[model samples]
Target: MSLQQVEQIISILNKQSKPYEWVIQEFHKVDELKDFDLDLETFELLGLAFYLNQDNCLSLKTRTTKIKEETFCIVDIESTGGIKHGQILEIGAVKIKNSKELDRFNTLIKVDQIPENITELTGISFDMVENAPNLKQVLRDFKLFLRDSIFVAHNVRFDYGFISKALHECGLGILLNRYICTIEFAQCCIQSPKYKLDVLKELLGIESIHHRALSDALAAAEIFKYCLSKLPYHVQTTEELIKFVKTSRTQRKIAI
Candidate 1:
């Protein structure tokens, strides 16, 4: 679709305050999107970028709902620190439900060579992954393991971005899993001088083999459980937890 057409739709949304269904009806008027194979729900999902109010289209705002009785996958990855330019060396994750670990996935990815700095930082060397499976195979396996669970990580964006990019390059497509960053959760729930994963591990007395993907992921899982316990009693669903974390972070930033 053309930029002008998209702009026109946004303009319509801005001027007309209507329900989400009404917005879709208006979107149908657009020539580009009219023949689009996607359905109304899919189209509304895209409207999330515009931050449209599902109930009443007024101003742009983030939308989050409840997430009770859902599964979570805490994930971590060790890479060359240049995901866009370099390679992923390892991936580790743990699936959790009802605050209990359901399963685990850990693997080393074969790479041409591991950079000296990366090896020093992660303790994963060229020799370690030389015989391991390639990125395509590892990503395929990880995707199956991950399924549709909510993705959790210390600094979620980093791991999520790297994995998403790796998957795309491997022809696996983008990751669509909803994700929560423990860093944000910790900031909202804990009182610590620093919110780094290692620092939290030390403060909480959680044993960890720092810099390894699985170890870090396990640590993050612990932190996530702790944060969940500290959440308001009313915050039960995944959507509520996410919204609470984001709102709390914003309030903390304003306080600072």
Candidate 2:
């Protein structure tokens, strides 16, 4: 088994009713070089440790069944304006694995500039952002959070394009992660004439609580879950889902 799988199995065992601590202690009882010296009945002792533990073996078996599934980091951003040229004011993302929300990343960012109208609209004044982390720092943390998962967002090009640009400006390389656009995913699954987030959320009964970074991120995560429920099993892997995202029928424009 992979090391991560081993770690997860250990975690599961720690939470269960089984005598896992005793099993771990039994393994420790055999000193590293001592086992080699104990040339006393090699095959018998080998069978002893391996056979005295049905619980340890069963925990591993359960976790192996779970390793085939993949996870996604659903994201959303609230910016000063709709344009990619406009700076992002806040960002939020949630990791979903095996139908569970596992991790989260969220932050408000300091922007280089913000117009009075944007300040009025988003309540994100320049002074408010002055002390916040710059895009570079924020992107660094975001990159660590995103590590190799499928990225999902509503109107994904807008969020993804701005993120790619921000990361590039920070001297970080472009993110080539497989991505899924909820707007397009909905269009494909539900055939909506209009797939705006609020529109689709209202139509589908997925409520948007705050519409700010975390709230929108949660809503987008729900939308992504809905899309996943509709997709076939073949599109389950991160790479395969990215392929589906790339071929989505929605018209997405690349920001200049």
Candidate 3:
């Protein structure tokens, strides 16, 4: 399908609360799309983008029959907070399978300077990263480390966006890995007054240091596991879980 057609499909899916099967049926009704051969993966990717656009939650198709069998790479990053202009100071990720942590990746990027305020926040100083590897090298290694595992974070957009942009600048291109947001999942799965990582850390009694990348990533991973355990029995697949969370958020907004 053409890029425009894919975008149109994504737009329609975003504005309406229809599942992939229903959306595909409606798309087939269009004379233009009727002749086009679109595969299940393309449709699912577009549907995945619909939710990602809503709040940076991207779910990819998984061959695993159960959630526990799937692999998740829970990631977190500490950056200069400059968005387009800032640089990433550190990256941390933990790979989990079958609800158990299998491995971890952590690194600091060399930066010429870091603001005092940022240093104060993350306790990462310019001196610390001065001798660390460059962005390109770190990203190269990180990309390989990530593989095809599902990308996850507390607020997925910020971390994922920064990493994606950095990768592009380093000639690595955008990350197509499906992402999940613990913050969004927590809002859907738990009735919490606040869903901030620190708040949830205290509320859920998860032991971890705050602010640092690895610790925060570990905290998010814990929350993710907890949320999965609380998911409805019918929500088994990744796609179903994404739909359930999106619908729950919509219902909550309407109630408010």
**Which ranking of candidates, highest TM-score first?**
3, 1, 2
Sorted by lDDT (best first), the order is: 1, 3, 2
lDDT score for candidate 2 against the true structure: 0.63
List the candidates' TM-scores in order. 0.74, 0.64, 0.75
lDDT of 3 at 57: 33
Give per-residue CA lDDT, model 1, range 20-57, as digits (tens). Answer: 66666665665545554444334433332234555655
Candidate number achieving the greatest lDDT relative to the actual structure: 1
Better model by TM-score, 2 or 3? Answer: 3
The CA root-mean-square deviation of candidate 2, after full C-alpha superposition on the true structure, stands at 14.5
Lowest lDDT block of 10, candidate 3: 44-53
lDDT of 1: 0.73
- What candidate 2 gets wrong by more than 4 Å, as runs, is 1-68, 82-84, 209-211, 245-256
Best of the candidates, TM-score: 3
Poorest 10 consecutive residues of model 2 by lDDT?
43-52
